[model samples]
Target: MNTRQIIIIALLIIALVIPGSSLLGEKEYPKFLEEPWDHSPITVYIDEQNTPPHYSPSYQPTVIRALQYWEKGGNGKLSYNPVFELANTSDADIYIMWVENMEEVTGAEEGVAGFCRPMIANGRYVHADIVLEVGDYKGYSWQQYGDDNMEQLVTHELGHALGLGHSNDIRDIMYPTYEQRENLNPLLVQTTYPLIVISILIAIGISGYLGVGWLRYHKRRKRLENELLKEMK
Candidate 1:
């Protein structure tokens, strides 16, 4: 072959070999877990003095269930203090001001379910307001109403209040769409099976690329030595 043809063939060989070699032994690679975020403990205070939908008896239990779900699902050790007595000094960081009227809730756009504003404490505190409607739960609207439905809404909103964004997984509590009021499922945990598989594939691709390059170098060196011995003989 001419010089140009030989050069072109060599480039083609490298292009095909590089990607092909990366796929070898990819199924048997080690995987790594990503570290969780470092977040401070959030305290939730129910406004005791508030009347009607705000300070109902069932409200406290629903909030507690939501907090417990976060502690287990997030794998986070979070301390929750639900207070009715108005102490001058409170340890809670996120104070939930429950409002009876839907108009009081901020960021309630035409189609949005709820609104959240980050309350900064020394430029670090994150807080928000949670509003509940008395007769709104039975209808088809997303606003929470009854005890069961209210628990579902509280679980979803508190997730946002705790610095969690909406998850795409329908099974996850953090998902934007509202299902029923259910406990956090193990399958929908942040560290899902797909992440493990992707991490393994990346590690294998890297290791195989290095291994194949070393093998090719040794094979070429041995061929060169054999050619030199034939010339000498």
Candidate 2:
């Protein structure tokens, strides 16, 4: 064959051989994935002693709402309680100590909104710094703004405190950007239908391969037996 034709024939042979060689190879992808969390129940205690007076009205309720939403949707378990004395002892899995002043906590700066910092040594508790603007009220700010501004913002920050990363989905509550109450999106449930279908297809393919292999084995054995019998005759 000419040079061009010979190169074309070699390319076709390589393409066919590569796929068959891959089928004989033992590489496999993992079928199951582990859930992110350790599945342990987390109890959170809000430090009432150091919490600012301005945040008293919206503080506890906003935290409770956020916790409820997380517990209901996520696989991990969480519980919360307001505490007066946790100064000397660490009891809960997560201690949410609210500081009256932002300057008291290291590595915490006043963000455009609220600020949160996790205790690295303990890694279980997170301290939140609440600084109210000149005109912001404790209880009335959430009520006046509704979901338009503060409630979702606090909820989003609290989610970070609870070990949740931002979701890329705009429709999920964990989205990086915050929306107003009327515009807020609820968390969506993850579905297993796609995974189930893919698993079934894999099973079908494996079964078909085994069946074809068994049939070919029997045909080869029968041909070898007839040849031996003819030689004996």
Candidate 3:
């Protein structure tokens, strides 16, 4: 082949070798995934004394809702079905408490709503402690940020406890700064095998029907010829 034809052939081979899915840039966020908790239906303990002022008991429902949101938001590699149970901090896989100085732990100049401390071992998270610091922000509370905003913040911190890191997309719930409610896209699944199985069954049924018709036609033809020959003889 000429030089130009050889170059064209080389380009075609390279294009065929590369996977189309890799070009799409679909990747899960990091941290919790490294050492995800193996247990299912994990329980979280909420400290009654460590709640935001005017937020205890009344705002507890919102915490449950946030846990459910993160549970459904996972990519299925790690499963979370968190059940909130009231208890002392010592006996808990996860703790949801309030802290007056949010900036001290998070190192943010302002608007540090909440943060989490994950206890990791063997490349997986064993437990975590989350703190919400609504008191640190002036004029901010469940009344000011509203139920929706609190839910967003709780969901974000819980995600960290479950082994997820921050995301660059502001819309994602895992983002460092909570701007909006967001969820990760579920992993894509292939339906090709089911479709192929259905097509094969349909082809077999049609072939069986056609074979039966052909046999009946030939049998009738033979009987008619035999009668005609008897009459001619």
* Candidate with the larger TM-score of 2 and 3: 3
Worst 10 residues of 2 by lDDT: 182-191
TM-scores, each model vs. reference: 0.45, 0.38, 0.54
Compared with the true structure, all predictions reach lDDT values of: 0.47, 0.41, 0.56
lDDT of 1 at 114: 38
lDDT of each residue in 1-233, candidate 3, tens digit only: 57885675555545433443233223333333533576655668877765545454544566788777765654343344544444555567788876544665556455567777767666566777877764444555323456766677788888777766666666777777742212221111111222233333333443443455555545554665564444333
Window of ten residues with lowest summed lDDT in model 3: 183-192
Model 1 lDDT per residue over 81-181, tens place: 32222223333555554555444353333333333344544333344555444333335554445677667777776665554445556676666654322
- The residue pairs that clash in candidate 3, if any, are 32-163, 35-123, 35-124
Number of backbone-clashing residue pairs for each candidate, in the order shown:
2, 2, 3
Q: Write the per-residue lDDT of candidate 2 for residues 82-178, one digit (tens) a residue.
A: 2222233345544554434333333233232343333423323323332322112344342223433555655665555554445555665556563
Q: Candidate order by TM-score, highest to lowest?
A: 3, 1, 2
Question: What are the runs in model 1 whose C-alpha is more than 4 Å off?
Answer: 1-40, 53-55, 74-91, 103-107, 110-113, 121-123, 134-144, 178-233
Of 1 and 2, which scores higher on lDDT? 1
Candidate 2 achieves a global lDDT of 0.41
- Badly placed stretches (over 4 Å) of model 2 are 1-39, 74-91, 99-110, 119-150, 178-233
